[model samples]
Target: MAFLELHGLTKTFGGVPAVDELNISVETGEFLSLLGPSGCGKTTTLNMIAGFLDPSAGNIRLNNAPLHTVKPRDRGLGVVFQSYALFPHMTVSENISFGLEILKVPQGEARRRVEDVIDLVRLAGMAHRFPAQLSGGQQQRVALARALVIEPPLLLLDEPLSNLDAKLRDDMQSELRRIQRSVGTTTIMVTHDQSEAMALSDRIAVMNQGRLEQAGSPQEVYDKPASAFVSGFLGKTNLLHGRLQRGGDGIGVIDIAAHRFRASDDQTCSPGPVKLSLRPEHIRIGKDAEDHACRVSGQIHSRVFLGDRWIYDVNCVLGTLLVYGQSGAAPFEDAETVSMSWDAAKLRIVEAGHA
Candidate 1:
């Protein structure tokens, strides 16, 4: 059995569902991320799993036991909120030891656990400092340490790094993953940040409109999105309308405007109107086009250098398509005619519309 499972988990307010029939499973010691936009029910689902919200219909199971029946405080789960929620007057050691104290743990054991967690989170010397003395990243680590000190079966984080600046957030992502791995804790974090989810999760469950859009490993979800909403949500992609035409040799042709693009035939859909998802990095430009199966001519309408890469908007007979090129190489200038090509295997057939 899965370590944590949500079967038909649902929640409603005023007769409207905030989370509807959501089903997902997390393995023991695995890191799963609930990812979606604001009000998409990712947070709502996390709240339900953490026992803060009751499911209107459906059930939650942990280790084959009913979790919905348990009260929030009695559930034995650790939660770290986005705000950190550290008390101002308490020292770092006190804040981390609070949970153990509540559980009536002996003073000696609590002190030992607090000290170990402080070292684990790299706050050894800062144990005497209050929340006001810590930086954003340090405060985040303290929140995490407090949650870990209790040694709960499950750890829940609600956008825990959202408040940090870009560099600090990036640094903490590595730290969080390291800490979780070192302790081998099963964790579930809710975040709207796509890169964060991809960076930190063993699996990502994307929610939309109170329903699960898709759930898979980061590479699987990115390279083979289940829907247009997922493709657009996960990263930059050129979404175009096309008509699928099945060919005899197990290949299919997509008709986009006057251009013909070949794609591998999965035979999941009949020849009909379809939506194509092609990532910008997948589309090769200039001499890089020589090896690809599908080729087209376009003019670079605009280009923006983003340190690590250059994003180009290329206008072709079909439409405007986005392309990404590495910054180390020379980039095509604006209005320059260029050849764009991509392998047939790189094209993805996604569900129509943004749902």
Candidate 2:
């Protein structure tokens, strides 16, 4: 049985659905991320799961026990908010011990748990300080320690690392994953940061416009998206809109202008316009296709140096295409004509409309 199950879960405001019929099942000790942009209902779903908001329809079950009627505090869940929400007057040790005290756990056990989490998050020396005196990263650790000291069955993190700087956020991502693994807790996080989700989640559920677009391992969702919104949202992707063509043995092709790109035979493509999605990194510049590769030519219109990689904007037979490649080699000047190629297996064909 699934450890956490959300079946037909939904929420609405002003008669409009913020979270439509959504069904998902998470196994024990699994780390899952609900990833999407602002107003996409990822936060709303998290809120409902945390018992902050009541669902308009459907149920949330944990270990076969329905949670829809449970109060947030009574649900036995730990939550870390984006803001950290540490009490200004409380020191790190105090903040971490508050939950235990509220539950009337023995003072000795609470102290032991607090010390363990403080070490786990690498806040050994900072526990004596208050939130106002700690760094952003340190405060984040305090929030995490507070959540974990209770040893809840499930932990929900709502953009808990979003407030930190880029480098600090990166460090915290590693720290967060380490602590979760050590404790072997089932964690569900809501995040708009794709890199964070990909780095930390065992699986990712991509949501858009109040509905689940796709759910799979990070690489699975990135390599093969279920819709245009997912392809465009999770990372950088160039979508080429085109006409559909079916060939022998159920083979499918998407034709853009005079160029035709191969589509997987397994995809159920409708008899109409289609969109072919390709990641920028998959495209090679100044290269011809190998025997099994797909080749095309384009004129470079612009290029940007990003230290680690170069991004080139090119005009091709299909449309404007973006290519990402490693930097430090000879740069392609504007207006330079270059050949681009990718493995025929790299392209993904999706239904025309965005998800």
Candidate 3:
């Protein structure tokens, strides 16, 4: 059995379901991310795991023991919030030691543990500083240290880096990963930022509305999205609607307005209906076609220069498609006809849905 498990978990408010029939397992010492947009149930699921909100249905288990009946303090879980919920008057050391003190741990032991966490979070030198005296990142570190000082069996972080500036957030992402690995605590983090989840998680559980859309390694989820929504949500995608034609080689082909493209045969679609997803970077555009497969000729409708790359809106007979290429590669004038191509293997076949 996994260290943390949630079975058929759900939460409802005023006749509406915020989280529905969600099930997931987290291995001990693994870092998992609950990732989705706002109101997508990521925070609700975290709250349920932390014992703050009782589930409308199902069970939460920690270390194979039922946790729903236990009080939040007795659940052996630590949570860090987006708003650095620190005691303004207390020093960093006192803040981290508060949980231990409330639990009646020996004074010496509490001090020792506080020192350990302060060092772990790299706040050793700021131990005597109040929350207001620290930077945003430092204050957030104090919050994390406070959570981990209790030596909880599981750690939950709710967008702990959201308040920091972009550069500090990036730095803290790496720091948090290091801290988790060193401590080997089972962790679940809730975040709406896809890049942050990709950077920190061993696996990510992507939620939508109230259901888990997909769960897998970052590469698995990004390179092989299970549905159109998953593809469009994780990153930019060029969606094309078409009919399916099974080739003799077991690959499936999609018939766009004026082009036929091949995708892997992993899709469960009827021969008459299908949808294909392509990433903008996956599409290559140039005139020098020495040797390549799946090429298409189109007219360049618009081009914009973005740092490190150029974004071209192409008007192909199939429809308008976006293509991204490295800067200074080739220049195509507006209304000028051009050829675009992409690797057949890069095309992802999904069940037919709205374009």
Candidate achieving the largest lDDT: 1
Q: Which regions in candidate 2 have their CA more than 4 angstroms from the true location?
A: 248-250, 287-293, 352-355
For candidate 2, write residues 41-95 as lDDT tens digits. 9999999999999999999999899998999989879999999999999999999
> How many residue pairs clash in each candidate at the backbone level?
0, 0, 0
Determine which window of 10 residues in candidate 2 has minimal summed lDDT. Answer: 286-295
TM values, all candidates: 0.97, 0.95, 0.94
Better of 2 and 3 by lDDT: 2
RMSD of candidate 1 to true structure, Å: 1.7
Poorest lDDT segment (10 consecutive residues) of candidate 3:
346-355
- In the predicted model 2, the residue pairs found to clash are none
Tens-digit lDDT string for candidate 1 (8-29): 9989999999999999999999
Index of the highest-TM-score prediction = 1
C-alpha RMSD of each candidate structure in angstroms: 1.7, 1.9, 1.8
